[model samples]
Target: MDKKEELKRRQADIEAMGGPSRVERQHQMGKWSARERIQYLLDANTFEEIGAHVTHRGTRFGMDAVQAPADGVVTGFGRIEGRPVYIFAQDFTVLGGSLGEMHAAKIQRVQDLALKSGVPIIGLNDSGGARIQEGVDALNGYGEIFKRNTWASGVIPQITVIMGPSAGGAVYSPALTDVIIMVRHTAQMFITGPQVIQAVTGETVSAEDLGGADTHLKRSGVAHLAVDSDAEALDGVRRVLSFLPQNWMEEPPVVKSRDPLERIDETLARVVPDDANKPYDVAGIIGSILDEGDFFPLQKGYADNLVVGLGRIGGHPVGIVANQPRVLAGTLDINASDKLARFVRFADAFNIPIVTLVDTPGYLPGTSQEYGGIIRHGAKVLYAYAEATVPKVTLILRKAYGGAYLAMCSRSLGADLVLAWPTAEIAVMGPDGAANIIFRREIEGSDNPAETKAAKAEEYRQQFANPYVAAGHGYIDAVIEPEKTRGHLAQALMALYNKQDHRPKRHHGNIPV
Candidate 1:
């Protein structure tokens, strides 16, 4: 064939592969084609695909017969909300979107581009693991992607959306990501498929039962957000990027508004319960205090016991972390610790000031928790909070006990401002637990054990457990009413907005307990 004729034949082949029949087959499976998904995800007419015309090497049998654009993984850079982001969308129709040598190279090239450009990465994962035809080359391909993921950690935001089946090694990329969004019906993530488990242990379990959104969000705490459809999942990705910067070096974009800081929500005055054990929604308090309807919560489902979100206190974007006493008695556990550690690191890396609302009895204590590596995970929270160099302000709403108090950005962590509500209990432990540990002899000697215990608990509450003791020792900066929290935090963040940390000429510290 002549040069012009050969080029025309290649063009025809590409178009035929993207013809209506093939594209419609993908649509019938309730998925968009690789190109179609990218188009929908990016700004209109803005995508400039990388490696758009690259093809497989000639040695592989039937490789030339297979027609694919960008090797079934459409990768490129695009704009969302006028900020640049890198994206990759897998085409499940092409050999189950399996990773071949060229396919892996396409993804790795885009990942390297994202890292060098310092733009956020969005991975639309819908693969059936590695390609068997390529054998070990496919495995190496996944390894390279993981290496990029490790290098990009904390440097830029990495987002993964599981739009369909993602099992085995495919799940690790999403697991390493900063945020994972999964579709309810079509998306599933698991370390091993049911067939593998059945082969090993003779246990028959469906994929949905083993790794669905319901299992991850409520049970395993893996998925950050769960949506009803692919459209909603993509929209969630856009919404999440709206709050973050193009890279960690820049500040998040500000939205203009003229809301006064001192405007108090009447609900805040009554939100805290008089009794310590009663549970009230901290998110409601957060909503009442933040700019109206601006609280964008991250990881809402994974760690319902703790709340993390981004919002403007006084026209300035800030990170808000709070405890929810309504769930699991507002106790910090292994999962909650991991959740908070991730949030603190993200905020510090991006220069967003952190605002923590502390209301926890203590870290959860049980045999199961100890075995689950709670100590190791809890240490991560402590290390993250301690190592953070950004401006931190904490508010004690009700309970702050023992190591949990220190973990929640207490005085020792260099919290710029620490405020406490009148009901705040800053203690080594709760009164009941304290009495049991410290007044055992007094209670054993007393004729009425119950009354003796109650009296001792009240004495501890009055003498050592209230916020005043911490204030006296200069641990707490001030005690304020719940109504004044918004103004206080707004003023605090504004003052410290320009604060910068200049470390000594050394590498980063070991993030230890």
Candidate 2:
């Protein structure tokens, strides 16, 4: 054959791996092929696909007769919103998108490019796990990809989009990434499928309930963002990337802020009701203080009590960890503790500053929490805060009690500046709870026990329910008015923009998992 005809024939063979039938079936299942996904995610005409002509090396079990397109994976470098990024999409239409030795090599090369170039890398995972024909080569392929995921972590941003089934050992690669975006009604991830569970444990459960978008987002907390469609998931990825820098060495990009830096929001004064029992959206305070009311909440469905996400303060990127009083009174439970710890570490790793908004009753005290290793999980948050060398600024919004107060980025945890509102009550416990123990004899001996107990509680509140006590001892740097929250935070962030902190020389700490 002539050179021109040979090139065309090879291109045709690459496109013919799954034929038209399999590609159409993938589309019918509401999933796009690997090429289509790359086209949608990256800028128009920017994707330079790599390894399109690579072939599988397996020859066992009639593998020689099998022609896998791009070895079931399409990898390339592209630009998203004018910023360079490396990406890979698994071609589920070809060999069920199973990973073989060459498929893994394609992904690892793009990942290496991303790391070397100091650019973000995204993986669009839609695989049915390892290829059976390749045996241990397939397993080794997964192991190689996972090593790259770990090596690239923190040094550069890593994101994963679960567009389809990611089962068996394949799910760990995404787990190692910084962010995960999954599509609803389609994306599913589990260590074992439902059939395996039925065969072993005999527990019957639907796939959706087992490892779907809802399951991971709301229950397992495995996915960072779970949207209705692949487009939405991709948009989520773009939004998150906008807040992060290309790498840890660089600062996060800052846009122009329409909201004035000195804007005082009086609404914050009235946002928190006097009735401590009443629930309020702490997100309101968060939105008001942030630039353009932007608060990108993470793990929103799971551990709703502790709200955490990346946001801009004075147009500068920051990680906001706030206590959501609307759920479980913003108490720190096991899941909430884990959420806070992981987020703090991520922000610190990426050179993003940390801002904590505190208003918690205390740790969630319950039999279930204790049984679920709340002590161990809660230690994770403490260790994260103490170990982080980033600029830490904490604001006490309402109640800060007991160890929970210390756990929520208090001064002892090395907060650069701990600011509190006038309404903040930094105490060992609530007034009523403390009054009961301290005045037990007085209440028990009094003829009017109820009235005496009420008076004692009232006395406790008057003395310790304000921020002045903590301010006097320097636990709180300043007790600012609610209206001045945005101004204070902006000033604080600017002053500490180039903060530096030291840590002992060590490879890495063994944090409580």
Candidate 3:
């Protein structure tokens, strides 16, 4: 037990407990080890792994027979695109990548580090739920992780990638994160597996059909983006991070650009429909106005009524949340509200300034919508927008009416700059709906009730529907030409690029339900 002999014995223990073997296994899996994944995800060779020597304490069930590197969960700090970020990647090969006591402790440690450092956290998840052998200890592991997620809410960005099978309670971590990315064939996520469902309901289903990229992206909207391969999935993560700041306290990175802010396109003049009832593609207008061409749409098919996308205005990445009047008359429903809320919170998390293009009639009015909790769902959109700390610029491309207007980044909700196009119509309600309510007495009193109602509606439209009234009342910041939208938004973003809001000695605000 001399000094020299003790040092040699420690070195031998490290080699015997899967040092080179774990490294080789990473190559065989056609993927990097948990540690290697952290290295590649971060700036080259910048990761400094913490708790690399921690291992399982269990010895009775031959647990000592296995060697755990980083406790099967690689936790560390590294630079992503030259900015510091905290990351964790679970090693699925190690004991099915279950969360044990040490593994959970490692995760919480890095999460606390991320909170202290005020940096974004990226989690590469590929686990088989909790470690059953640990029983209550495993549940406590998850409880600690959940506590970190709740504490980190609105303070830093949390990203989760489901690179492999993640079942049971493991799914909630990603559910609380800002974004979730899934690989097409490799990733599978669900609260419970199909076997459990079959046992409970006597209905059979496959895992892929139950929870795959197709199911998540199209049906559940659980995953924000899906890629065909692991490489693409990783690339998607980088692309998403590029638009975001390290945290809410910092401004999003701005790149030099040659695109002119005032560059006008002929399409902008004719993009909107002259008739109020007719529908036009909002995406077309967005595509035409954003920088040259850098529009990246998220959740495109799942919630068709609302359009959420990432794009560059003068080469500065911005989150674009617009209402698609073409679908369901651009009405806010439960699903669309949920989709918009998620996108808004995501943008706010990373300090990516938001640009909302509103063209909505109002919330969808129907028995199905009411029963499905439209009021609860619609409030999410308002809460998200109101709580957002990033600079928000909203444009009224066509119709902006009622509570929908407030939910869509109106001036009252702390919108830094609100612009309206000449064709915009800002009203308490659509003229037809207003006429039905206010002019009921006049219309019902007329000999020709139908003709009187129609005339009243037209009269109301001419008097109160135009953007001029909104601008005059200071409800809108500016009434710019349609072609000038790109420049106006870029300027507004630049003006508020250094904006910061610090609460008055408060740990956090009450996030509205």
TM-score of each: 0.93, 0.98, 0.89
Model 2 CA lDDT for position 116: 95
Model 3 worst lDDT run, 10 consecutive residues = 10-19
Predicted structure 2, TM vs. truth: 0.98
Selected candidate, larger TM-score, 2 vs 3: 2
Instruction: Give the clashing pairs for model 3.
Output: none
lDDT of 3 at 111: 94
Cα error, candidate 2, residue 32 (Å): 1.4
**Predictions ranked by lDDT, top down?**
2, 1, 3
Query: Per-residue lDDT tens digits of candidate 3, residues 448-509?
Result: 99999999999999998899998998989898888777777778888987888644567655
lDDT of 1 by residue, 1-513 (tens): 899999788756543435677678767867767676677788888887777676655346666677665566777789887778898888776667788788889889988999899899999988888887778888898998999998898888899989888988889888888888888867899988899999999999988888987778777878878888778888989877766777788887777757778877777878988887799999888886788847888767776888987887776678889999999888899888988998899888877889999999989989999998899999998888877888999999989999999989999877888999888899889999999889999999999999999999999988876799999999999998788788888887888888887556766677643
Error of 3 at 41 (Å): 2.6
Alpha carbon lDDT of each predicted model:
0.84, 0.92, 0.83
Overall local distance difference test of candidate 2: 0.92
**Model 2: C-alpha RMSD to truth?**
1.3
